[model samples]
Target: MLAACGSADDSAEQPQNQDGETEQQTADQGGKADQEATFPVTETDAVGNEITLEKQPEKIVSMVPSNTEILFAVGAGKAVVAGSDFDDYPEEAQKLEKIGGQEFNVEKIVGLQPDVVFAHESALGVGEEGLQQLRDAGLTVFVVKNATDFDETYGTIQQIGKLTGYSAEAEEIVSGMQDKVDEIKEKAEAVTDKKKVFVETSPAPDIYTPGSGTFMQQFLDIIHGENVAADQQGWVMMDPEEIVNRNPDVIMVMYDYIDTAVEDVYSREGFDAVTAIKEKAVIQVDENITSRTGPRLAEGLEAVAKAVYPEIFGEAEQDEEDQAA
Candidate 1:
């Protein structure tokens, strides 16, 4: 599972055009006023809550990493005043004020006086009461859904864009993401030999893997790789014996923050008998790219494709030759 963290800093500087006006400047000058003209906008959130916005929000707080990424990607970075402890993407998010982690700091958040706050559906498990407190304070709070696939992620971007007055930018971002996914799918269709892959989210002793209906499974399908755990559902803890029995062609480790090593997987007593271990095909993937449902997901897809089929999707031979020179 992705860990919840916080952030601390300031809003990003807006990009300026030839007219010496930044996007934020334009929004402040007239864009927000125009948005307000269409206000009293009503929308349903992921957790089935109806949210009505009477005016454009100038101050925003994002309580989840994915929401923070969406907010920044859709040109609302300047509006974000605080983010969860786990939001560390885009460099800009790192500068926002930290508002606690999976358990939010309700007092601090209320003190910030944000016009809008973004939360995740998953947060309901632990932060629902705090969210209600925000609502009780007469603040507008929106809950983003927990995206299991790329389509839902795109929908999340669209929803956030509409709320933040960046609908056009959100649509453009979605189009770009769709184009990249289509390109990947086209490449995947050309592969004649599919490899069975095992994805490990946690290290041994108690190992965890994503099965059917998870993003990792979808990613494997996109790259023409078979998930060894496809028979299972959701995140399941598998016995080492089960992994040995499956004997995947490739093993992808998804934890980078821990001290776990690829060598550890290769050296496991019974694992050496597996094809992946015997051939030294154990690969490490960035947890954020593979796990976070955000703007950089396409980059994550490209990385997975390359990891699974280096010969086909890896760096060009010409580039390698140039580097050797």
Candidate 2:
């Protein structure tokens, strides 16, 4: 996903200073050009709009949970004065004033007077008008895309850092994430027999799974596990019959807002005959970590890796004991 912050309006009304010149006139007289040189940062957002920032934003608002997490991770948490309703990470984010979710509160955002607002590409579907209103109101809006893999996630982190003056911290965070992923990949290479896994993003009757060309598929490949839905593309609804026929060795249930459980998957009709159900290999994973494209994505990868290959990654405590002995 791409992100960009817009420059302030040059035509906005301004009062005259002690120098007998209006603020806009002063800006046009070279002050604005000089400011742009000091903050010569420009980025292309998800919709391919080139956004330029004239200064570091002090008051910020995040309309996407992933962006909110990235903002906090890069040490720009203090700049975020407002967040979306779903932003709950870093604990402190929950304390921020909630502007709105997919349907943004344009008036609330305008009242907050944030220097910039982080949004998601999905907002284009329904919130585009609201976003346009924000832009029209002279608010800098950065729209992030729906990242399909770790690379896009990293790009988003870097973009957010650049916009928030936390580029160095973002690079450090990205490097650490890369190192952790490399370690996991190296360890996964030792597995001679990779497990075939099925990831359920939603509950039964209306089951949904991440297919090929998605972050979940990439994650499965990184850990040397086979995604049963790899043949299908993108997030698709799967029939229970198809899932049962696949007979996955591991079933990962990814949901938390509902009352769905591993037992629920195990007890589903026909599911009982599946290898995962019979062996009790149905695992419930944190949807936020596994799904949200942000700094905690490494944690999601590790969680999936451990879940699929417990024999390799789950022996940490036992290995330490053996070493001590």
Candidate 3:
């Protein structure tokens, strides 16, 4: 597993001003010339637009929950002066000023005078006019790609690390996550009997499973489980009768639903073909972790591993929780 090492501290490399506040590097050159010295942001946005900032922004506003988590994980949380409405993870993040939902409030964000704004693909589309207004007012806007798989997610982290001037920290974090994933894969190789799982994404007890090409599928693969609804793309709304026919070995419900004592399988009348329901192997997972591809994604992976093979990964999951606590 990737060991979390505290070998190099990046606190020193973070620039500080005379007043003890972090300062953004000036855009020395104009236009494309300035892009060279700026934070090394690579990769195109969802709209296929290349985004490059002039420097590490001192004041940042995060307009996506996932992006907010990434910013905090990269040791740039202090730089985030504002956040979107749904950014409630990581207790410290809740303390930031709210800038509306993924459909961000451009006026509120503009009022904050952030040096830069980090937005998700959806956010830009939903609030393009507002975002453009901010850009016209001289604020740098960077829209990162929404990765749909593991490799792309890892690249997103590295890309963010490059943008924030924390390349080493980003590399170490991703490497550590990679190691944990490797360990899970290695251990799961010994299990000849892999569980087939159906993951439900809604609170209404609907049969929804992530498609074969999605991140959730990659997450399940790391845990040595096969998604029964792998034929579809993204989150597909499947019928309960289809789920009964599939009869997966395990069912994953939203963690919130666990407390509510709800079951998508059990709710379907006269449908008990699913082995998971018979064996009570249904597990609940945090929706935010599974839903978003961000810095703490390793936690979500660990969650899946624990839910799938509690025997092998129980101790590791406990250790991760202890460390987080």
**Candidate number of the best TM-score:** 1
For model 1 the TM-score comes to 0.86
lDDT of each: 0.76, 0.76, 0.66
Residue lDDT tens for model 2, 68-127:
878777667777899877787767788999876645678888988998888887556667
Task: Estimate the lDDT of model 3.
Answer: 0.66
lDDT of 1 by residue, 15-52 (tens): 34235655445433544324433566677998898988
Worst 10-residue stretch by lDDT in candidate 3? Answer: 3-12
Candidate 2 global CA lDDT score: 0.76
Predicted structure 2, TM vs. truth: 0.84
The best-first sequence of candidates by TM-score reads 1, 2, 3
Per-residue lDDT value at 12 in model 2: 8
Encode model 3's per-residue lDDT on 1-325: one tens digit a residue: 0111111000011232233432222111111212333454555655676767556667889877777776666556767899866677566678899877634566777788887777666444446677667778777777767777667778877777677665555565677667767887887777678888888776444556677877888888777788998888776988877777888887877547345644644655755667888877777776677667776676677777777777777843475467457
The count of backbone overlaps in candidate 3 is: 1
Whichever of 2 and 3 has more lDDT, that candidate is 2
Model 1, residue 76: displacement in angstroms? Answer: 0.2
